[model samples]
Target chain A: MGRQVPIVDYLVLDDGPPHLVAGRCRGCGALYFDRRNGCARCFGTDFERVPLATEGTVRSFTIVHRAAPGVPVPYASAIVGLDGGGLVKANVVHTPADPEHVGLGMRVRLTTFPAGHDREGTEAVAFGFEPA
Target chain B: MDATGTVAPSDATAGDEVWVLGAAMTRFGRYPDQDLIDLGAAAANAALADGGVSMADIDVLGAGNLYEAGSGVGQRLQKQIGQTGIPVYNVANACATGATAIRCVYMAIKAGEADMGLAVGFEKMGKMGLLGAKPPSGEAEAFEPSGRYGSVMSVEGRLGTTLMPGVFAQAGMEYAYENGGVGFEQFAKVAEKNHRNSTLNPLAQYRKEFSLDEIMGAPMMAYPNTVLMCCPTGDGGAAVVLVSGERLRSLSDEQQARAVRIGASVMTSDPWTEGDQVQPDVNTLTRQAASRAYEISGVDPSDLDLVELHDCFATAELIHYDNLGLCAPGEAGKFIEEGGPERDGPTPVNVSGGLISKGHPLGATGVANVYEVTTHLRGEAGDRQIPGARVGLTHVIGLGSACCVHVLEKANA
Candidate 1:
């Protein structure tokens, strides 16, 4: 099989269930999906690699009917509070893009799907949350 | 009597009084044929005439413009409106560009750097679409990984791209989810009120009024935000003339009468964190800036005669009413429902129809608000005038998230 690539640098594609990577502040335990220079809360530079939980709860969501050129419309965007720690914004998949259907406090699990191709035509993968 | 009976021979301090001698704005709408400099020059010339002064009297130029005309915009503006080779500075703080330019001149005059200054803001939003994110460069790269760049590179950012309306719609959704379920109807009420207010403002882009039902039934761009609730992208410019108190004495009595004292001007930026709630996302910055303005002006929210605030979206106006301390938290929707922010209400807001109806020209918006407030304070607002208006406030929040608040009082009041 050809090698697969993750769309963003923070996602880890390995054996077993794929996990999202994050930086955890050693001082205040604040988690960030991206690399950190210092903790905004404790102002500490010490950080450690931590994998984010796949399950999370939707804090809020919106059905974006309009978007940039080439991006599909009427997709549901959400702020998901991770069960492990940290918060992330992602698209909701396998769920109808309706207010009544996708709602706050809804349980969801992280899942990866084929996004598009890179310059070399290798298949790239993107992550999102789906109704648990 | 020390020659003039006024306090004399005092050393100039940073706290020295500053006055807005004049303010003017082009009617905010699309001007496909006009360039940004032309818009800036027209507003600047009108402001100079309104202040009863000529370009030769302006000691410096502070200009604000968002995009397109890259560097040396101030110099270009001066070239268009008679360049006296005065020192010129260009300021760009996204939507708060105009207000930031005003603050720059205010600081200069306050520090006695110059007795008279001209601040102008112009922008031509050529097209309305999603704002693409550019890669961070140089020093910005060090901090970019931890900031918005991180969010933009995340899985969420890749799944769906957001424009201005989407961002505000998310905030509105979060507000409803957090609060006891504020709905689209309340948001529609805000659009209805501002569109109605625009009917009286000749400079407003959308002068036709829309009923709440019509606004609610309008095309939905995002959940809870209809087409009517969003400010249209347009091109325009606004200018303000600032003079020191000592310099004010040299102007004609009629010019002095038209002046409005810049009691306080404060600007602040976002202290955002990952996963922080977004409804009151701008509250911390706005509160910090507005509190300082109120303290400096010695004016409370209840003491204001009128207010002109940034309403880029209908929901933004609702949230700003709380952010500016005009109402208690969770009371913004109720305040609107009771007609508390009408032209005749206890604290009139957006008496110039706000960005929703007046059109948002990015760099020009902040100064355009100043123009509206000055007209009201001078009792020269014609039919849109707030009766006995003595003090007014202008608040603007730009999205890389900066907030600017200015308090103005009738010069002699």
Candidate 2:
């Protein structure tokens, strides 16, 4: 257990720090994460490597109840519009328990958690939201 | 030809009618405790009551359910509620399920297939987890490219809530840069406005009050859409009762006055031969539907004092504010900056807080629009009522593929 690194995470670590990832369209200026069948903005098929935005504002949010097994209960999630002009919904963290204070349009940004720490320590890392 | 010129089906040679004698809805939310069968029967019973007729009078039963388990819900409702030998027909069309059911019953009556018909939309939203919100991949099991992913949320559905918030963030940022100084706070003002109006509506899922700063500080779902911009999922059902022309007018003035006339109702499925730009198709549908309703009812868009549009997203509502011709196209965003449509604007849309505030129960949402429109026309939308609302319209676009627009008037004839 002396600083063991998963093969996938170790491989990606050489590429960049902060380890954020997104897909940028080649044909159009559209941006997406995960793989896209086609570009939603300009219907462009080509995409390039692009860094994910670090900051944004909260658009909407909700608190989840009855969590799945191995996950924390009463998790906070939100829609964050990034500084680069796009939106992403993720779990909210380092914020108040009540959603009233989370508020819409307030400045927010991206956050990441320890890989494999979530649920039985899988190699997958996750993102959370914080006050910008 | 453009979308507005399309002709309406000529079912009436004048004096023919499809009268809404009854309507009902299941309480909207997660039905962890309720069964679909019970909910459907209850809604059908409520509709029968609203129509002043018993289930015995129903000649046809049309059930609209979005979940796979509810495929045969209409027959179950007919069996439980004991309809009068009515042939039960199940209708499915994604978010437009209810509208399809209503249209089917109306067309069946117009064609003389049934004397009276029942249209019901029931949803057990939390039962199978989420009924929709699936991937856009063609290979996925639930992928029905022809299906609707709700009217507004279709674009950002599978992408999770992030990209949606991002677009809103861009719009909000641009709005601030364009205007002197306004940002999320401005969006918060609109949320505050709707939440304030929602307190008076008992049917609303979220009746709690929220302040400007409070909503402004809420967690963002996508950057511009805080939790307030989005609608909650609720378990609810709505039913409509329709009958032929003669049986409707025989009632007293008080009874006759409650009749919500269906002037011209048209459902259009867009041809996918073109690209995915839905703005033109929607605009075309609205114009043509409005035109036909105007011709049939002899009233135009300028004459309507109220409207209950499909405001699934703030962006959709903002875009539609112009597309619906409430004002010029590009100026739809100005209404938020200004005090327009504040439940007292020149022609208020969604005075009942719409899907955003009132809640969207998927299968029941289309019928819910009808309920709000009918209430406004009947002068019964208590705190959010549009005073002197005589003629109105309820237009709901399902996913991007189809749009169902109905032109309504107060009187049957």
Say which candidate scores most in lDDT.
1
- What would you estimate as the lDDT of candidate 1? 0.80
lDDT of 2: 0.61
Identify the runs in model 1 with alpha carbons over 4 angstroms from their true place.
A119-121, B1-15, B130-157, B276-280
Cα lDDT for residue B398, candidate 1: 85
- Give the DockQ-based CAPRI class for model 2: incorrect
What are the TM-scores, per candidate, against the unseen true structure? 0.90, 0.65
The local distance difference test score of each candidate is 0.80, 0.61
DockQ of each: 0.34, 0.06
Candidate 2, residues B42-143: lDDT per residue as tens digits? 777887887788877778887887774345788777778884666777877766777878888888888888878888877766634323334442222221
| Candidate 1 clashing pairs, residues 3+ apart or interchain | none
